[model samples]
Target: MSTAPTLIFTEALVLLGGAVVAAPIFRKLGLGTVLGYLAAGAVIGPLAHIITGAEEILPVAELGVVFLLFVIGLELKPSTLWRMRADIFGLGSAQVLLGGGLLTIAAVMFQLLDWKAAVVAGFGLSLSSTAFALQILNDRNDMNSAYGQRTFSVLLFQDLAIVPLLAMISILGNQAGSQSASLWMDIGIAIAATLAMILTGRYVLTPLFQIIARTGAREVMIAAALFVVLGSAMLMQAVGLSMAMGAFLAGVMLAESSYRHELEADIEPFRGILQALFFIAVGLSVQFNVIFDNLLLLALAVPLIMLVKGLSIYGLCRLAGSSHNDALRIAAVLPQGGEFGFVLFTTAVSAGLFSNATASLLISIVTLTMALTPVVASLANHLLKGEAREEIEEDFEGAGSDVLMIGFSRFGQIAAQILLASGRDVTIIDDSADRIRQASMFGFRIYFGDGTRLDMLRAAGIEKAKIVAVCTQKRDVTDKIVDLIAAEFPHCRLFVRSYDRVHSLSLRARNVEYELRETLESGLKFGRSAITALGVSEDTAAAIEDDIRRRDEERLQLQAVDGLRAGTHMLYNRPVQPEPLVKPKRGAEQPEDAL
Candidate 1:
């Protein structure tokens, strides 16, 4: 009997049970699931010792980060990265160099470590947690915003920055001779591996998916998705780059594939579970004893490091021409220690730059910062001027058309098609990146912009357009765009999509040239088709539909003057019979038939 199997089962059970119990409770408490998982891991592993070997679990759990990067990569096309070059190179470089320099100075001024160790530690701590920051952004649905893009660009540069920083540790350490040469060799290998992945993804992946899809076996497709993600991850790991970097490259390669959405759908479940496990694993790895021993020192150090990093990022974003709100958001999202810090610190310890105790103390500090990130971010919300929203550049290169459509959501999408088919030049704009990408694949040219902004509206050619169609999904958003247009471009005709009966009345009050309730036409058509299917002829059905439409218009006009409940009698209803006593009458009718 192998007790090893039982131990493994017990650990799995404990982890699953802990996650199940903790995530919801913390979510209900408004602390977020990341913190919940951390709390649960802390209780089960460090405090109670219900589960052991967290260190061993960490390597396996890091797959969560790898999958997360892969999913993010799917959302970004290479062209999108090209568009973000200035931020990635210029802003990212400044943050790392200046931020690392500031932290190094702080460490040295305090006599925290020797010069060699301080250099490594400073840069290491300058790196913020990609997993933690991204999770926060994703939960808030802000990953595609201007600030989010800038934040991600900085994190990406940090990931690239790790290689050189690691090389610097080799040159500064006691084992400089062998480690330096090995580090250079590893760099070469990483470059070659990256190139290989690019070629394989370009030439092999799409066709492979095509063949598998032809087979119509959904399970095989899922396995293939997993294989591609894990295989790319392992290749990068083999060449000394982070596994996440490789998976991201693979995702970028496949970004233009027609199957991109399907692939995302396939990988999402695995990414979610693994990501949760990764957060829990972070919690389990918390060294409470070390934290307690250095409580006073860390109390000073953690906030100092976060402050230095946050101020540096905030300053750099402002200088780079970001709005004050965006700068504040970028600062709030990234002012914590990163997962890569653990790798750098442990490496420094091995190279004789720092002792084991020092590494433990740094690790403890990072863990505490990771746990505190959500709270710090929450605090940042109070400091923002207004509700923060994701914004994209308003490009109107070929705009200024006959019809300007404000939103490319489902309603707008359908309306645009009708306009296009009728040979109308319609300019479409939408704020959703996913919708933009999907629409682009189908040959739709949509400008990325928020329609509520007057500048964005002007750029999209509201003044030149004969009609401005407001087709935003949300009622409030639609109202805002309509109001802005009515106020700013009063001469322009407005065609608005109404949410419901009440909304139709409100839009009418706003004096739009045209307003149609979103579901009214569809509901009427469905009823007509259903009646035609049962017994009514097509001509009769058409007449019935026309009658209903006329009655509805009449009802709306009456309701507008008399209030919502004033037109109830216009709706058709079956009349009730008060009494029917036909038994004796039936006998009288039988007598007539007999005669």
Candidate 2:
């Protein structure tokens, strides 16, 4: 009898019901959503035993990781990865090698397995859970943080290393030179597949996106994006590489494409739910029998492993130039084992390098780590309270705005209102934490920081910005920022808020294209309204107001020139010379003769 439909339905219910219940509970308990997702998986897999296809669901769940890698790759330009090459190759390599080496020694001492099995176990367990770490870092908006970036570089390296690691496991299992040759073959195929993806992405994907985008079909665009990710992953998998690796490579290749943002937009929804499913699968796969039977060993193993890995990562991050607090965060965030340990342990067992008992114990330990990841992240974040710069930066990212307003004081509200009214993408940045909070309460996504900083500007997408309006109250501070913006981002149109007549003159001297005196227009409006209220008709009042504005502008223009002259005179250094204009009567009279 064909039971495929029934099986599928049951699996769907298990996943759906779990998610439906877990989200609210986790939220109410003030736990991370990941905890809810994992709980759902546990409830389905271990508690109700609703589905008999956890293993089948494993591969399906892995699609989330694949999509996630692809999306991460989209974020990682070659330049970004290259810039962090030291961290990737240095800290990342050492994390795997030294960490694995230490773990292997510990495993041997504990008599967990023979040296060969321990070696495999060590390498596998040394990896931090990428999904868990990135999810936390991303949620907290620490993706660009010093500690977050360094730790992520290590995670990325670990992702890349999975290919070789898997190959190594296979070779070790067979204990054969032939397996090594097969790996070389796979590597060649992997290279070819990668090149194919790049070339195809460069030539084909953008055009496809454009055609679909023109049709205005959201569903088609999303389907096309899915195809791209899944296709790349499948191609890589077909060539002896992980699907995530392939998808990631594809994503990186398309990072700079015109369609990159659109692709991200389309793919994000799928990646989130799928990634959640991937986490749920991890929870579901946790073996209660193995844990209960070997409770003492697993318990002893989990804490020890986390401690060693934590210390190792902390020292490594410190060596990489992170602050002590940041190092503590990096350490705590990454001590947990990764999802790949399951694959590694399975490969080892299938290859006869490890017995069923050892594999079960190791898998349990890995699952424990995965389950505990959110708690660790929460604790780390709590300990680093009043120091959540990562989260602060993250809130700005979601705005993905085109216009960045540097100050959110009363002056800033004018530009903000205009932009908001016009339905323009607008983001506000201010140094005052209290002001930022107030704006947030009033439904503004205000980024709190000293906006004059280049790092802050970049974080707010200064490069991609169309307009930047500086409305800070201080003239000198405004001028300093104007210079920075002029120097760094000449393409951006700057609209600076001037404090008064002198500030406006200063701005004009600086060759600012747009300078609005803070009180000039408002004071003019007050005069116009008063004139109309006194006796004049509204139209006559407007005419009189316009005429007055013209005269004042003419005077202002003359004054601006004089201000420039005055500044030049102040800075002037006359050469040592005879006293000027003692008597020039004959030459001075020449003006009449010339006329």
On lDDT, the candidate that comes out on top is 1
lDDT, candidate 2, 148-239, per-residue tens: 88888888788777878888888777666778677788778777887888788778877877888899888888888898899888887787
In candidate 1 the C-alpha lDDT for residue 580 amounts to 24
Candidate 1: worst-modelled 10 consecutive residues by lDDT: 586-595
Instruction: In model 1, state the lDDT of residue 140.
Output: 89
10 residues in a row with least lDDT, candidate 2: 586-595
Model 2 C-alpha lDDT versus the unseen true structure:
0.80
